[model samples]
Target chain A: MGRFVSIWFRYLRTDWFSLRQPELKKLPFVLRSPSRGRMIITAANSVAAQQGLHCEMAVADAKALVPELQVQDDIPDLTDKLLRRLAEWCIRFTPLVAIDPPDGLLFDATGCSHLWGGDDKYIEDITRKLQARGYDVRIAMADTVGIAWGVARFGNGSLIIESGITIDALVNLPPEALRLEADVTERLHKLGLHTIRQFIRMPRTSLRRRFGQHFLQRLDKALGSEIEILSPVHPVELYQERLPCFDPVATSTGIEMALKELLTKLCFRLQRGQKGLRKAIFKGYRIDGKVEKVEVGTNRPSHHVEHLLKLFQINLGTIEPSLGIELFVLEAPIIEEYLPQQEQMWNESGGLEDIRLSELLDRLAVRIGAHVIHRYLPDEHYWPERSVKLATSLQEKPSTQWPIKPRPVQLLPKPEPIEVTAPIPDYPPMLFRYKDKVHMISKADGPERIEQEWWLQQGQHRDYYRVEDEEGRRYWIFRLGHYHDKIYQWFLHGFFA
Target chain B: MLPEAGVIMILNRKADILTELQSDILRLQGFRTVNNGLLDADLGVIKQAFPNASFPLSCIHEFITSQQEHRAATNGFLSGLLSSLLGVDGVLLWIGTSRYLFPPSLPAFNLSPERIIFIDVSKQRDVHWVMEEALKCKALTAVVAEVKEISFIESRRFQLAAEQNKVTGFLLCHQTKKISATACASRWKVSPLPSETIDDLPGVGSPKWHVELMKVRNGKPQSWDIQWVDGKFVPIYKTVSLFTEQNQKAG
Candidate 1:
């Protein structure tokens, strides 16, 4: 048998606004957003609702009805952010919490409510907590998700439906309680089917032909014949370890101890499975209902408790323990398959495969950032800047071999314009002045012309030259276009060692 | 004749004892010759200036640069040395503030760019920290860092880390405000030298440098004209003889 609970936030957006701005609790205001070429009221607080204002009503019309009505712009995605946060908090009540978008949370309360004494105390505890957080909620428990949702939103009488009487409880509900489309509900009402009780005895073939198979599916789902899956807010992390404190942990030492414990357990589990974590988060749930977290990423999959703990230790200062934390959870969101390697007799293993190398890189990344560390592989492109591509992983191999053409040891980030004296078209520069210093060329290489990849972008071709000065300092200089062209420029691109 | 032979043998033994004492002093100064033989880079006559006639592997070597050309020469020379030091699969760490070394050009020095990891840290302190960390890892063949400034204490820390593992370190100090004393095995200044093409061929040839060993803990401080060709260092004999003639006339 399955028992589910649904909690509806009647005025989620407005309640959040009032919580942020306490003055909005008494004043009549509505959240307005432009829709269909008009400002429609998206949500209204209870004060405005009592003043004869409702959702979907035009703001101008509402203003005409109530002169003292206040209109505030509605924030996009506010409902989603609010509901997700609330659902994450609701995990304290039940492990399986699913977000019912716009304003609700669905929980598979199966085998869970008994822990709080019974279903009644569980509901009271949830209501008191949400209400304390300034959310007005109506919650209902039933044997299926559909019945729970219907009872939470539109049902009357007892909120909890017994295990065997799901159909009896769903019969009194209206057709819209089945979660049918608006147009379908409108058609049903036109056919005088005001409630599920009115259409209870209808033939299955006729109902399928008239109202469609979706309506039947909903009806059957509510009656416990069809199963409805609820995807939880967080996917169950089998690699996660949790530690609950008897006395709230307030000191940094306590937090470290908790982290070490969690890491030890997590690494043990990972070792047993021959898997390792590439990314993990250390979360501390405080008594004040706030979660402080520190995250770490590794260049390679690792389950070494000391190494992973050191990575977290670098950022532990960022976590604030206000009012103390009661629970600590460490979750590895990204894991990879790993095979344990036997220790080598000699320390000849010095490359990407070395565990110590990866550990060093991980420490460097945590301290300074992973983006600053780079390894490059040869690319097929002829453009000097695009000739090398950054390797995304430690083990990535180059697709092409390094170009054999002589390239400068140090390449300027951008080509610097220089003054040049050349011998007409298609000839190397005789002399060049860069950074206010003149370089008289002693010997010069060919004007190797590299045309722009016209398919990638539009630009002029470059004629490059490897020129040596009297001091033996070589430079890779280039002409932007043909020397005979009306508009031409020379640039010192790089310095050859 | 037997007496004369005995005297010559005594003198040779005295010279060998002096060399041994010199190596002992170098070891006390923290310059460790891990392999105690010639470095794989084939540094030509340049090896004569190092203690035990071999490059120190487990200590810091500092390179001083003032101009862009000099920096380029140092990078090229470092890469050539690294190509030999880093065996087939050895990894190197190149930590600097900015990434100006073209990745594809490392192959010219006989080192695959893929084998090198480049770390571009914005702060000088972070670069030092990363260099020290990289030097401590036995898995790395060498660490090459270009920092704006390094203190005597920071350089000492780098030496300590390098000695823990037999990882070599190359520190390139560019445009530093002042040349501070450091705990390095050798101090060098590599400047670009005019290239010589084979058989009067046109255009530039192999990269060459006037490599100056300005300071060595217990060895000779000298200069050499060296050229890189076919993945090996070739001493320029013509320049050496010309320098000798000029020195003789001046003397």
Candidate 2:
């Protein structure tokens, strides 16, 4: 049997949910959910564990142990999703990663141990990397998956069993380490066979007759007498390249140079296949085993090295390659067909500068955020707010004609209520008090009766009036509902410049 | 023989004129140096308030209100100046702590408030840095900062940046600031005058301001009761009534 590694995430359900929310980590907490009309504790954090509270215990008992224990509902599905994501991240270390149910991952290291120096060093590298990202993990390597899983969960810290000694390693451990059913372990303890060494000494026929065939099968798997197939989280075949440095690179320039060379090779393969990447991730594994990753996205599928380099440049300053990075891995997770781009840009004096404008926009969007830069296109709605819609791209054209009516420079998100005094309900206010200032109206424009769009389920008709104050300031105010109705209200909405 | 000799003398004088023209062109292009203080292009808008000459252009001007109540009128005057300077092409950047501008009210001062880009910064330090950067951009016509009184050094830096970039700046100092000297082209205080109704009509007239030019770098201090009508500023009769407690008390 080849060497296999088991990664154990202790209290996985508790760790995964509290991974992002660190405040809850310090408190004695338990994650419970309503099942069969009763809330039972599913998992507990390190704090609650010191209080001697265990899983499957009633919430009443856990609370009795620690009165102020905080409780949250468990999300088993989300924990499974997080586990799958961690499995994907494990690919950065080795490709043959499989999900060992509940809280562990099994990896068939095989001949890959030499890459990280040896089997022991490989375990240390992965442990440090996972711990740096704030995950509590224990790892064990052995000749078989069963023994590795047993040692990882029950062994001291991390252990690598000697080759062909899997049976001897399990002899000292309790019968529970065999992954036996609770009742079977209890029955063996009553029979004065608490240790696996005592149980293995018995004849196979006696053990099989006492327990079932499943118990013998588990025993055989752990002893390396049985073979188990491992299914990797990601397929073994993917377009990826890895470069291990002889001497670590500490500066940004060195990282950029390495990145450029790596992209040159990767893009060459992509170009040969006529494929372009929509998303590219550059990962730098520091000598201390910490991985710094920067991801960039393009609006369109692109394989242009210079253009992709420009996008990556925006993220270069953010990556902190502490100590020094010893390896670089670049992966293109999203790719599409590459098509020739046309050069005709409509911006005045459009040559290289127009292309630079898009690059600048990308950099600016990265800095100030995406929502700040918006392109507007006209919508067919008569209501002013719905008259223009935000366009996702500059190339989008307005489907409807822009309203010729003069629109205010800024529209209030919500209409503010104001006191009004007018001769008639249908007319503009002769005097209005807004924010404790009275503006006497001089010139008035309309009662632009705008009925709500019939397609909308519910709304009242509004009559808008654009009135100029004594100071020559103009305001767009509207009266809700019918003017003749006593329940109608007036609101000041927009400003006219 | 004498006529030919006179023609040669005239040709030599023409050659000297060509050399003088070449040096003048070089000076305009900045290839040759000009005196530092003499390069201020401020006389253009100075004539608006100061009758003797006028406030300097291409420089930062401080606008202060006499009382806390005069903020709206001072803002109106600033808006009017911005529109005059911007004319057609450039946009004005107004950096302030809070947004108190009502766009519909801007047309009274003949300003199109829509052309102004408002930058609301929360921190005190970001205000100065953003203002300085905004003033450095040549594409902008002017930058107006509504910061709680800036320091003299910061004002000098703003003035120097404005002169270099040729973008005008208005520093609207609030009432809370200590009255100190700054390196600005000029400073003015504006107070609102009660509107005058024409033919005893019901509403107030165009906005009028009691403008006081407190300090002028290279011009005489003056005052004007100015009114915003049509699209230009015109002198109006001074009124004693100010918009104060009487209206609020009446309500």
Candidate 3:
């Protein structure tokens, strides 16, 4: 019960070039490369092909045919790089995607098409998205990859072959559609066997003797008599639970029930394995062929079904079961070993090890981005800005103690320059003006002189002063560099209470 | 018996029963008198204005700050309280739009900055949401949120969560909008006062503030001058009655 999709990029290289340079898209362009001391056309765009120019043709001959044709050197090994990137992008359609190489992509579409609603809409979505990105692709879906590959390139009209009907759908195609060598195809034509339908009924041993074992293997693979395994770009996650509904589920309650069931089953398996999921994705396959998914991430590995469900429930509104969903899949792509701790006898709250605390953090991280929730630890740096670093995890402890000296409670993101009048060279300012307000210094303590870390960056040393104004408000101000010829540049760095 | 004497005795008996009923209602509303040596919040004379002559826990407290200096003073005072509440390994959540609390400075208030998880959100609604959610978790000792404003309903929700979970919440609200009523147990206004150095030293001494209790649910509203000297709040001007109250309870 496996289905496959083959996407043939007819003009992959030129389309990539066009996507990079829009001006070359309309012109008849060919990518030429030097091979065997001769410049050969490696790829030609559709416009160039229409003008009787094609790949493997000499650049000189192409130029002679169309003098106004545009020529550019082909990049070495660009095909493999381009195909791999395209294949990775195709993962959104299914978890399993493989590069067909040279100019094609293979997808294991089993149970995936229903997420997009149906087969027709599924293919339509893929083709439309690729076409929107300025790529020329021909796609075909069938029960076997061989038929999908054959129909995508050579067979014309309605590339999707019905299940159990691939033979009939591919019967009239030419023998070359089986991807045979030149000698075999030529020998077949010489024997007056131009179409596959003409000689498909012949005995297998005789056919093997005529065209060899590789040719029959390809034929049998196309006809579903043999299996072909696709090496996926990214391995599928082992912690995945799937539920197929006997009837379509359209209501929110139904979706919630489906999600809860999947979570229970998944959590039970995780509990037995002594592992927990850090991130999970809940996907529902709609009857209309569209896939709706919601993702939740936790601060720590969690097998708690209720807490995880609460996190997912916050985002369940975004999933629309348009016509009704018929299938659900839950995947835990990230998992970690989680050893359960013993229950507290007196229920004393532990600091970082508290499950309730981590659950709260996880909920907060989901609502507001995870990046916004941070814990800071002191770093061994003299610079004020670099003095603290964000802890990577909850269990991280500070390597160094907090500075003993008094610092401002509020530190500005960047220091604001202030106008100061100091009578002495290194003395604290007598008066300073910030934001059109003047403050008279009543008391001061300063010239801490924190130099910039030379190994980390290059900057002038700052002479910091903790000054108190007549109103009793204290400020941390610094003068940049030296007092250059009796002139000083002071900036207000922070406020202290 | 004479009619007037009998009426006075009946009135005295009725008054005693009424007081007992009132205390019972307060206890049912999540307000229990803090016995001596039961809590560690040594807020000096300021604690006398609470319902039971002790700093209230498991409730929402609102602080209104108009200027940056006032905000700093409030944070310093809050850090002092947080340090005591966060007994050994307890943690606090400080949520706001932008972080200005320098981590290195928290040590001066007896708080390890690492123990405080900072949550910086871009929206005010998110600040309240995080505060409410954090308040519901009993594991956290306290939650502090710096927000522009909060509605009555939102504050009520926070109060309910704190009451149910026994977690303290502090809302550092900016006084940019018109002040409205909220379901907080107490409201405070703290402003910086001139610091006095010991023995007339040259530099600024320990931080001092004018702490005003603007509103309290079932207690007196009063103001006091206090200074943070060596990680504890000490009243600048001592009153005889405050000491006698503590001594009487101790004896």
Best by DockQ: 1
TM-score of chain A of 2: 0.52
State the lDDT of candidate 1 residue by residue for A1-497, as single tens digits.
Answer: 89999999999999999999998899998999999999999999989998889999999999999898888999999999998899888999999999998689999999998999998988889999999999999999999999999999998997877777787898889988898999999999999889899997889999999989999999999888999999999843478899999999999999999999999999999988888899999999999999999999987778889999999999999989988999999999999987766224222566877888888889999988998989999988898888888999888988888999999999999999999998887778889999899999998997888888889988999888999999999999998876567699999999998
In candidate 1, how many Å is residue A209 off?
44
Error of 2 at A420 (Å): 2.6
Could you say which candidate leads in TM-score?
Answer: 1
Best-to-worst order by TM-score is: 1, 3, 2
lDDT of 3 at B104: 87
- Backbone clashes in model 3, listed as residue pairs: A115-A289, A115-A290, A115-A291, A116-A289, A116-A290, A117-A288, A117-A289, A117-A290, A118-A289
Candidate 3: where are CA atoms >4 Å away? A1-237, A342-348, A485-487, B1-30, B34-41, B238-251
Alpha-carbon error at A297 in model 3, in Å? 1.1
The lowest-lDDT stretch of 10 consecutive residues in candidate 1 chain A is A341-350
* Per-prediction TM-score: 0.67, 0.45, 0.64
Over A400-448, each residue of candidate 2 has an lDDT whose tens digit, in order, gives 6555554443356678898989877566778998889998887776788
Arranged by DockQ, best first = 1, 3, 2
Tell me which of candidates 2 and 3 scores higher on TM-score: 3
Please provide TM-scores computed only on chain A for all of the candidate models, following their numbering. 0.62, 0.52, 0.53
Per-residue lDDT for B1-251 in model 3, tens only? 69999999999999889767866887898677534342445666777677656777888999999987788888888888788778678889999997788988888988888888999999888888889889988889889999888889999999999988888899999865678888998888888887889898887778888887777777667778889998788998843333234433432
Q: What is the DockQ of each candidate?
A: 0.58, 0.03, 0.52
In angstroms and one decimal each, the interface RMSD of every candidate reads: 1.0, 7.2, 1.1
Residue-wise C-alpha lDDT for candidate 3, range A149-224, written one tens digit per residue: 8889988889888777878877888888787888999999999998889988999899988788998998988888
